[model samples]
Target: MSMQLNRQLPMPADLKAQHPLSPAVLERKAQRDREIREVFEGKSDKFIVIIGPCSADNQEALLEYVHRLAEINEAVKDRLLLIPRVYTNKPRTTGQGYKGMLHQPSPDKAPDLLEGIIAIRRMHIRVIEGTGLTAADEMLYPENRSYLDDVLSYEAVGARSVENQQHRLTASGMDIPVGMKNPTSGDLSVMLNSIQAAQSSHNFLYRGWDATTGGNPLAHAILRGGVDKYGTCVPNYHYEDLMRLLELYGERDLLNPAVIVDVNHSNSDKKYKEQIRITSEVLHSRSHSRELHKLVKGVMIESYLEEGCQPIEGERTYGKSITDPCLGWADTRSLIFSIAERA
Candidate 1:
């Protein structure tokens, strides 16, 4: 006997049909994007700090957190260019778990994707307006770009997607500075290829229209450690490794040769407390080696209102990460201050 299949289907309506950006928002985003590009080009020496929740599950909590960050920005205005990571979506390795607030705001509930998109956009806009600080986010889905392209200042292609042709093509057309992270296996070559692809002109299909890209000159690299079965961080951001990578890029003649060191991830072996040590060590190495120092542009840290992380299955904890363990506020503050002093 043949069995019938039961499958749920997505609605045909466009996600942005309900909510669209006003011209004012687009202008604001354009100005912010220019400033970000300036910083990436070394025209502005401000140390870019992209900080926020590991996954923004609650809009209210994220808004409150950015308000505090804005205050910190005022205090460190001379030294840092603050960009809150209002990351609404996440990519899983084996494609399991909660994904992010966009997929499942409530752990036990079915995905309200339409509502999720609106919630994320609202939260992002609020952060930009409320804190008066620029925002950064990972571009996970190309289709979702239209909804957010007007509000974000900086864009990132995460480790899992850096080598993807679709992501590289998308980055090529982005007006904002794009940071391409090294692969999860700690391969710098993949990042270099991704960066090169993003910095070159390309023609691809986009939105039912033929599109040609002007190419992004502000595309760069991000060094986040690698994970293996034994659980050790490889390709540690040491002076030699960084120097070699930079030299390779120079040889390849890539437009942007700078890199951002991700202080959390494998670099810290996922130990939130160790992020401080790793950051200090990298800075010290850079200080002694002029070559590496020139190649090192900034740093990225995973931080939130609270420290560490809690599982989504049990009772949820406040301000903690649902995906990865992040450095708590206290540790984050101390690290930022220390790094600023070093700068």
Candidate 2:
């Protein structure tokens, strides 16, 4: 006997429509975009801090965290451009893990992608409107870009996807500056190629439509450290390493001249405390290389109201990361002050 297969079909009521960007949010995002551009161009020396939970799983926790961050942002407004990481989607190496708020908001629950998209947009809009601070996020899926294009001030292409043609094409047309992270294996060439791709005009199918992009001149690189067979985190933003990258890219006229250093991830081997120390060292080391100092525009940090992380598939813990561990609020505040003093 043959068995019949059954598949559930989505109902019209179950589909969520894409939300519209409010005029107020658009105006604010425009101002934030200008500020970010100024910093990238050397017109402003403000240190850009992209801080938030590794996975924004809990809306309440994230909102409370951003409220606190807003207060700190005001304190360092003159020297830092604080952009909260309202990241909604996450990429996994082996295709397993929490994913993020947009994928599996409730552990073990089936995905409601339509609702997930709307939820993230609503969250992003609320964060910006409430905190009065700009925001940043990694663009993981090209299809999701439309949901966020109007609200984000800054964007990043993660290490794993930076080498993909689709992501590069997406960056080329981005209104906001985009940072391409170094490859997972710690290869700088991948980032270089990514920057090159993002800087060139491209013709590709985008969002189910034929599209043409003018290319983005503000596309830049990020150093997020690399892993070796010895199980050691190798810092790639050292003065010598940065100088070499700059020099090489300069020779090819492909250098962005503006780079952001990620203090977490492999840079600190996922040790949240080390992120602060490494950030300090990078800032201190900058004084020795004039060219590199001028090129090192900002830093990226993973921080939240609490330190460390909890399993996503288990009982949820408030204020803790559902993905990678992040610096706690106290340490994050201290690091911001230290960065300001040094700057």
Top candidate, metric TM-score: 2
Give the per-residue lDDT digits (tens) of candidate 2, residues 1-343.
5975444433322332335556786788788889989888778878787888887888889999999999988889898888898889999889987677787665468776755776787888889889887788889997677767777888899988998899999999987889999987898888988998998899999866799998898899889998878878787867777787777678666535688999899888898888888888778777677887788888899998889987766576689887899988898888888888886
Query: Which ten contiguous residues of candidate 1 have the minimum total lDDT?
Result: 8-17
Per-residue accuracy of model 1 over 278-301 as CA lDDT, tens digit each: 778888887887767667877788
| lDDT for each candidate structure | 0.79, 0.83
Clashing residue pairs in candidate 1 (N, C-alpha, C atoms within 3 angstroms): 307-328
What's the true lDDT of residue 200 in model 1? Answer: 94
Per-model TM values vs. the true structure? 0.90, 0.92
Candidate 1 residue spans exceeding 4 A from truth:
1-28, 228-231
lDDT of 2 at 258: 80
